[model samples]
Structure formats: structure tokens, C-alpha cells
Target: MTEAVSRRTPGTPCWVSLIVHGLSATQDFYGALFGWEFKPGPEQLGPYVRGRLQGEEIAGIGQLPPDRHLPIAWTTYLATDDADATAETIRSCGGTVAVGPLDAGPAGRLAIASDPNGAVFGIWQAARHAGTHLWGAPGTPVWNELITRETSSVAKFYQAVFGYEAQAVVSADFDYQTLHLDGRPVAALHGVGHALPRDRGPHWMTYFEVEDTDVAAARVVELGGHILQPPREGTSGRLATVSDPEGAAFTIVRSGER
Candidate 1:
């Protein structure tokens, strides 16, 4: 199993969390699916819970505030050193700061923001917690991407906010690009040339690697989750789109198919 020994690099997809109303049900769902062990997070961090794999931090879950009106979904966080500066930059870059430039106790500052096309993500400047501690295996998050039709504006907005150099990948089937930080690929932007049906809006798509995509997809359905896309083989592996009972969508990928 691969493990991360240090903090994630700035501007990379550094962390993820499920902001759900039903914390207990959400905890049980993910725990059974990913084989995660949930532990009470630091008390100063409010109702946040850290999800682990073999005792290594993998992801998190937090109770959604009743005062805030937002959908239940997995929020992806991009690493930053200055959340307040980043929030201001997000506004200046034509994006919106939907939530905070607020303290997350000693875990560092956090700010929720959305790109020009409404793809929501978080800015994290970790203090005591440096994001995911394990990766590159079953049940570990491996990639994050934004799905949108507004490729140019979205790409320009992120580059302005994060100082990323987005390089387009030439493909006959679709329009896609990769965000680079110091020449290393960090994330991707995929243009489907159409809005997502069901008013899903433009959103960040997080991928969690699994031992078997087909099996996971089936289990997701059996667990009362909905299958958005059936399992299919790709160059990298078999993948599928699925959503929790409350309609928070995510993807699963089984690696090394080819």
C-alpha cells in the first residue's frame, strides 16, 4: 500500500470530505464501501470525523450546518498556504467564495469557492492536518477533475486563482486538459460540451480507486445508491459513476486495465 509521509503540495487536490446531513448513515455507508475506520476528529474542529484506511487518514466527513443551504456531496479541497488571500483572489478571478476564509481550529484555514462555471471546491491551508495520509490503492482517492462545458473560462479562472498552467490534451473524442504545478500534473478539466442533465451543474468529480469497479458499482446500487454510469473499461481501467442515497455523485476506478 502506498502512503503519503508529508503534506500535499499547494494547488494540488489535497483533501476531500462529505458534507452530509445524516452523519451516522453517511459514516456507515462509506465505512462499509471503502473499508474505512471512522475516528472522532479534533474537538476544536467541530463535528468533523476523519476516515482512515489501515489507520492512515484517507478522507473525512463533516456535519452540514442547518443554517447553510447546500447540497450533500463530497467536496474536494485544493491545497494552499493562504486561504484568505486565495478567497480574495477567487473573487478577483470572477469566482465566488461560497463559505469561509474561516479558521478550522488548528487544522488550518478553509474557504469554499466555486469557479466561473459553478464548479465548487475548497481551499485548504492545513495546520495540524496535512490532508490524506494514504493513497494509490483500493478505497483511496486518486484523482480529482472538474466536469464542465465552459472550458476556456473555467481553465482561465483556475489558472488565475491557483497559478496553474493548464495544458490541453489533443483527443479526437473529447476536449480535456490537465492542470500542472511546476510541470507536474495535479488535476484535470473535462469538457463534455453540454450541461450535465438533472441540473447537476458544473462540478468537481472525485475518483476513488477500488479493487473492482463492477463489484463496487453493484454494491452501490444494492446499498440504495444510484448508478449514474455503468462500469466500462477505459485505457486506465474500468470505471463507473455513482451517487449516494442523497444524490452526491462520485466515481470509482479499477486501475491498470490495459
Candidate 2:
């Protein structure tokens, strides 16, 4: 029951959203897996739906436009005071704006951008909606990370855009680091070390906390989703990466409780 009662700092991972091919099926799949409750946004919001836990907003799901063949993927958004300004920074830092700094009626202004490494994310300036209201526990998001082969350039690019400092983690086999702003861990940047299909490209990965990793991973498979990684034990407990039937990828972790 970790509820975010106030605004997050600028550059924080403020929101995560999914744009999927089938809206209804995505709703049912998450609802049954996480016990989430979904509320459709105003009519003008089209197929937008807000997913919640204990009445606090946790994430969003929207229907993919019929004419677009865009991959079903979850987006991670960073908090900003001005979305337009942030988009400018993205461009100045050698990134590209993939979408608008458009208004979501009362939800605020937002734009999607891809980093120099081609990891796509969003910038959000909160209006009536201040992004996720709850996090850091089971059934809520706990971590966000970007995996790319161009670690040095990506580090410079993000620091230029968001004032982030990448601190290397103590691992010999994995070239990974956490991004921090004002000494608070906001997200992560990891070097893709092993053989992942080249077509996957560099991308941001969203991780959700679950009560039980085995159960959750099994449930994902049961509900027409595919398990990208089998459950594995680590210092952080059991975790796995999975994709919905529509092909959006995300990870689930049970935290330190085994």
C-alpha cells in the first residue's frame, strides 16, 4: 500500500503506460493477474484506461491506433515541469521526438522521445494527473531500466538532458549502473552484455512488483502471454520477463521475500 501523495521530482520515473492492440483483453489479463481495477478515461480520451490499486492510479492502458503497425510496448515517463522544454532538451542532446507535447485534456502535456541509443520514453508535465499515485510494492511498479549497447554515449546524452549521474554497480560480468538525480535513484542504464536478438534494439524495460514470481509468471502464460525469461533467483528474489499476447514486454519481481 505504498501511495504517492504528492508530486515527484523532475526527472523521476513518474509514470508507465501501455499501448496495446486489444484494449479489452489487456484489461482482463492485468486485472486477473494483479487484481487491478481499471477506470476508463473521459470519452474524449478514446480508449484510454487508468489502472489503479486502492483507488490510487498505478498505470495506464490505451488502444493502439488501427492504422498504425506500432509494436505493443509499455512506455516509461519522466517527470518534467514543461514538456515542451524537455522535448527541446531531447533534441539538443541528439535525441528525436517521436510524438507530441500534446495535451491529454486534464491529464497534462506529454511527448515521447527516443534517446541517442534509440531507447524510447516519455516526458510528462502533470496537470490534473500527477502520474502514478502508488508504487514500490506487490502489484505496483518498483523499477525501470534501459538496456543498450552504447552505454558511454547514452550516459552523456541523458546527463545533458536530465542532469542524471550514472553510478556503476559492483558487478564484473554485467556492465550496469543506476541513474540518480539529486542523490536519489530514479532509473537505470544497463549495457546489453549477452546475445539478445539484434532486432530487439535498445529499449527501456519496466518492472512490476509481484507477490509471487512463479505464480505471476505462470499466470501470464495462462492468460495468453509469453514468458521471455524463466523465473530465476537472485539477490532481489525471483523475477522474470514476460510479454503480453500483443507483444508488450515487462518484468515481474517478488522482491526480497521468498
Clash counts for all predictions: 0, 0
Expressed as tens digits, the lDDT of each residue in 184-220 for candidate 1 is 9889998887556546788899999999999999989
Candidate 1 colliding pairs: none
Per-model C-alpha lDDT, please? 0.85, 0.86
Worst 10 residues of 2 by lDDT: 192-201
What clash count does candidate 1 reach? Answer: 0
Tens-digit per-residue lDDT, 118-231, candidate 2: 789999899888888887767788888897884767888888888888898777777777899889888988887555437678888999999889999999999999999899
Best by TM-score: 2
lDDT of 2 at 193: 55
